[model samples]
Target: MPLPEKEAWPALIALCIGFFMILLDQTIVAVSTPALQTDMGASYNEVIWVTSVYLLTFAVPLLVTGRLGDKYGPKKVYAVGMIVFTLSSLACGLAPDMLTLIIARGVQGLGAALLTPQTMATINRIFSFERRGAALGVWGSTAGLASLAGPILGGIITENWGWQWVFYINVPIGVICVLAVLKYVPNFPPHTRPLDPLSIILSVCAVFFLVFAFQEGEDAGWAPWIWIMMAGSVVLFAWFVYQQRRAERAGNDPLVPLAIFRIKNFSLGNICIVAMGFTVAGTPLPIMMYFQQVHDMNPMHAGLMMVPQALMAFVLSPYVGKLVDRSKPGKLAAAGFATTSVSIVLLAITMMFDLGLVSALVAMTLLGIGNSFVWAPNSTSTMRDLPHQYMGAGSGVFNTTRQLGSVIGAAAIGAVMQVRLSAGDPGHAFGQALLLAAAVLLVGVVASMMADDGTRDPS
Candidate 1:
């Protein structure tokens, strides 16, 4: 049965607020680096760690956290996560040194890992197939808005209120989320699967090693050690997969149940998310650098240009949501990825030649419009067919895949940008970087074309 709208919509709203804040943390710190370095007397490398460590820690536990929601209740885990996140945010804001800030930020990441999966799982659990597209649309819109808003908000807060405000901003929002969660969010039935600690440990290490190698590879001059670690990550992950499958056959609870992948859309959906993550994490580097370094725009001005992108997402998403409810998600998702791909390619072409800022804005707005279609539909397609009991496992895998994609994308794009910069003109390098990102996005289009089995909403 569909949830009573009275209860469902309010809970989604509360959850979105917290979800928005958590995702915002991904990009917000980029604008605050200078302020933080000067204030804390941290070396440049240490300041970089402030962001990197957070990313590393945030990505590590997602698979486990998703299952945690299943074993416990979503409301309980979500409530606890908020408290941990809020207190850590407080610690981050008041930190005496870089060391303290990084530690607090890592803790914040842990809280985030706990909180992320419940969002999708809860949406999947509460909404019916016909209605799920709309709920996911809101979730997708929040994500789109957060990506654009993080930079703008960060610039404003960092300039006027100091860097601490970025962390401090989470405090009131967190408190409100906790209270809203308690008041509105339902307690989902527990999955009752025994916790799999070995799988959890392996998954965490696999993610951590892969991310560490990719993020630090170029910085460390692509050293042998990084390669070895990367190889070790792959081997460890292979073993983890083997163990999960063996556990499944043995009737033991696996960290990430392989059965979740038996659903068609869910499997392909993951491939698309990883590709999107590459572009989402990849796009801003060249554009932001082009804005500030090429055009000499300040951080705030550079950030303002992204507003049009978010504007498109905000305006177009409701209609897209309706379409997602009615149409085959594969078609909408394919179109979205295609449009997004074209937008980025055009942006690279126009920017590489220094065509005009107006052209770049137009391109990004189109990209944002395309962004409107991709997230919700893919999310809907992935989780809609899964059994209710599997929502936590499904949500965790989905989100973890997305998070891992983001980490990989950031590292890959950074390496490519550095290589291109060393070889030729900055503008040309930026364009090449974006071209690579667009190619990655195109992979999503191809994967999406093969999604949505025509089982729920017909083609």
Candidate 2:
């Protein structure tokens, strides 16, 4: 049965609310890491582990959980994720020590991984390609906006109530989101696929190795063992791929279906999002650090430096959404990412001078304009030709790559900053780190240019 337009839009709103909560959690912790260190008497590394573990847990199980959404229904899977996430958020808020906080954060990551894939899959299952562009525009903008708002919200909450309030805040929001999903989101018939335990094990080990190696490499001094671990990660990932192929040939369900890779735009889209993921999650750290560490601004003021970018994204999103629905997505996405890379370069240039705060606003506003274009278009176009039956798996793979990229970005930028800070001025180091993200986003721009909406027929 066709859903009434009124009901359909409401469903999207509820899902977006849930989606916003999860993303907000991802970036919120970054701003509050300093507060956690002071409150808990923890070392720098231990405080960072709080954030790293969350990314690890959130990212490692995405492939499996995404398929879980298909085997069960998205509504059921999403509800369970919300419950787990909400409980874990409470645990995070009440923790008396750093260890307990890290443990609770790991649990929170599991809930996040379970829920993340369902959002894109839900949108894919509900909207047609023509309309999906607009739906995805709202969805994508929420992600950029939530991330941009995280530091601001975190700074305010941490300043007013304490760092615990940052986690505590999620408690009510999560509960409300659960109720919203239950009331507004419709449940669809579930698909049945026999789970392959071996594939699961292989994939888990591969992700753990890669994410841990990247995340801990700098902290570990890029030791010989770290290099070995990187090599092992590559080998394990290849083996995982081989195992999936074998399972598929044996007529068993593979963790990742090989068929989805045959879709050109889908393939390109996955790669491109990885690049943007690096930029989106990686770029803010330097800006915040430069403001607080070098310029001596308060946390709240540091966060406000990003307002122009988020505001621009908000203002331009509606128009960009219409463009995605009306025009060629490749050109739009390519142009958007390209514009962002230029902004990043400008940010880097401004970092060389003491005029970071004044100059960065211009760059950030320009970056926001670019985000309005690429974020939604890439999201919609990549899945445009995906078969409905594989929505869960396909969306899962795309998100998994993105999250993997995000964790790596966080790790890589952290390493870059550490090195630059040791070698030169703190302000210059901050700006240098921004350049790495710009380089990555430029790669994404190239990938986006190749992601033609009509290049492949619908499966």
In order, what lDDT does every prediction score? 0.85, 0.84
Give the per-residue lDDT of model 1 (tens digit) for 1-459. 457878899999989988999989877878898888998888989998998888887788888888888889888888888899999999999999888999999999899989889988888766767888898888888887787789888988998999999999999999999999999998866766576677888988988888888878878998999999999999999999888987777766898878778888889999999988888877887888988888899888988888888888877777787788888888888888999999999999887898899898899889898899898877877788888777787888888888878887877777888888899788888888888878888889999999854856321
- Compute each candidate's TM-score over C-alphas: 0.97, 0.95
Candidate 1 has which clashing residue pairs, if any?
none
Candidate 2 lDDT over 82-127, as tens digits, reads 8999999999999988899999999999999888899888887776
Best-fitting candidate, measured by lDDT?
A: 1
| Model 1 misplaced regions, further than 4 Å | 457-459
